[model samples]
Target: MDNGRAAMNLAVLLALIVSLLFAQQPKQVVVTGAVPDAAGGSLTITGENFGFVPFVTLNLVPLTIDAVGGNRIVAVAPIKSMPAGTYVLTVSYGPSPQETGSFQLVLGDANDSRSQSSSDVPAPSISGASTDAAARVADRVITVADVDREWQRRDPAGYLGLIRQLYDNRRRIVDVMVADELLAREAASRGLTTEALLKEEIPKRTITMPESAVVSLYQSLGDLTRGATLEQMKPALRAWLERISEPEVAKMNYVEELMKVSARAEVFLAPPRVQVDRTPQDATLGSDSAPVVLVAFGDLVSASYARFAQAFSKLTETFDGRVRLVFKNLPLVGPGSIAAAEAAQCANARGRFWQYHNAVVLPPGAVDAVRLKQAAADAGLDRAAFDACVERRQYQSVIKDAIDEAARYGIKSVPSFLVNGRLAPDPPPFLPPFDFLKRVVEEELSRQTRKP
Candidate 1:
């Protein structure tokens, strides 16, 4: 009995091992290659495992075969079943199975047709223009082509509108160049152009960009399109929008430079209108006699204000006790912005000013009322009290005081920084020419040390 039982167990184990070994074998099939639909009228998939009579199926679309050839098989991808994208091609014959790799259904262009030759569609060429005009036209063409090429490579089917824009921009540049040359020629023939005036006027470009004009342009371009998608006109839209804002950008750049021209520019030295009697300061801040007080007038909504906070934090760390950083809130974004200010003040009242400030002034989109209240609650402020304070606009007076002070000092924007009683030059990121505050503080420190 024992011998018979052992024999049965060995036979069962052998059958199990054989089943596992067969399962480990790869699927009995091979796929040579798949040609895209455009390469030929039909996709040719070549491979073998056909049992002298191979049966094939493509996504449940069955195929019948009359004969099978050695190491190769041909199957036509169904035109109606497959759209323009990649799809799998499968073939099966009972136990013997094969699956072809991805077959691409490409948009058929003239170039892909077998009857067409490479020489038929010649590459775009630039000719028949004056040297400078030709060069400008060429640059414009290249810019349009490059942008289209990139967008199409990723999203071919969706870029028809972009291609149209490229053509339109090319036409506009061509017209502009032709007209410019004609004007130059006429001016020369009539002797109406002076050397100095021409030189000065050529470089001095005045582009007026009214805010309303940009809003109108953006609207006309379907920025507020009625349907599901905004049209893709990025290349032209970017250049035109930048062009429209040239005057305002230039004016701001000029103002920033003027403020940095001399050590005495004094951006923050607005004429004082009121005198408040000084009350003796508290003992909480160690010694309240710091020589330099850097006041940052900031708004939560404005982009520049966040940048100001970062640079101010760095400067405060660098100067330590010599500089005491004071932040005054403007909170002009909306109700949301005001609520944020109130929340911060509530945290400050609980001796968690720095923690709350850091949390709120974090990268934009990272702050909301929930997170603000959470930070306050974590900082040991009563959640209910903080909630009530924010909802009731308890710190409106605080924001108002900051605004009143700013108005008195002729300040109109957030990120307006005062370093030792002078307004710091608020240059845009691209043209941050100089740091006047740092210079003044360094100069004053040097002067005092020299006197001793």
Candidate 2:
């Protein structure tokens, strides 16, 4: 009887312990509101279960956190002059960095009288009233169409940029999936595993780099080698080179052969295109009526821009009369960037824009007043007139206007390209490869031909 009583007591204790453990577990975090300061320099986020302190990012860029409480967080934006648009605010916390929630943060000009306070702004409705309505705010019904219409009306370019980004992401994923399926089917047809088939085909397509070529690559490393001799780094260097080049190249070549030559895979997915207007102020190359107009936004001092410039030069040559290259200044980097852009404009007035542009960008150096003057000489410009134009800052307004236009198009980074009014879907800090640009130009040409 004592044992039976003791067992019942133990069971009761266990139940109590389990209930306590469940109760102690933290509630799932939820971001209820985000409010930008009047100056738009700081953002305050209100949420539940932020877990002491949480890491926050606005549009994937980490914010400099200012203050954190259990239910509130304040952080400074990365960009001081953030363009007015809808931004994604993401929060993550805990030891393993579990994402708490994502909140949509709509913003307007800070000085705009229409800007509302945190209390005035409507919270996103969590529950739907009916199938037709997206949300119910008290007695008022908000439909998806209504939300979209309002968003489009407020910022058409931002809305379109978001849509294009979404389409590009989806298209990229679909391409990968289709390629995977094609490979799987091909493997099955050969009565071989995909892995086995890749192993058989990849080696045939791989190129073995010669010893001399490897040495040349090592010499090109310069300071990147960190005082290490070529002989000391030879094996590792070869391995690194092979790792970056061989397998990927072999795989891509094989996939191209399968898709283009063997299976003749056709992707009918149409890419999203925006109407990018050209102006007389734009410095351009090639015929005005060319089917492919490639508008390039770049900073003169940017290394990425330089790389893209080289590719652009090659592309113009390859396509000849078919492609028109338009250059627009987006001077985002360094103190000298704006000056360089202005100087380029001065060069443009003297019919030396391309020559001066190539001299400044094609070389690896910081652009300054001295270099600008020297480039003017190299480009066969009237140095006295060029200097005068730059001194007066004749094109400052033009550069400012260009910057504003870039912001309107949601372009925040340099080396951005728009091919025939369609923004090239390449992520920042990297330019599209020459082959990719060629393919885009070819596709644009084909598209134009199909048009009645």
Candidate achieving the largest TM-score: 2
Model 1: how far is 354 from its true place, Å?
A: 1.7
lDDT of 2 at 17: 100
Quote the lDDT for 362 in model 2: 82
Which regions of candidate 1 are displaced past 4 Å? 1-287, 364-366, 378-380, 431-452
Taking all chains together, the TM-score of candidate 2 against the true structure is: 0.61
Compared with the true structure, all predictions reach lDDT values of 0.50, 0.75
Give TM per candidate: 0.36, 0.61
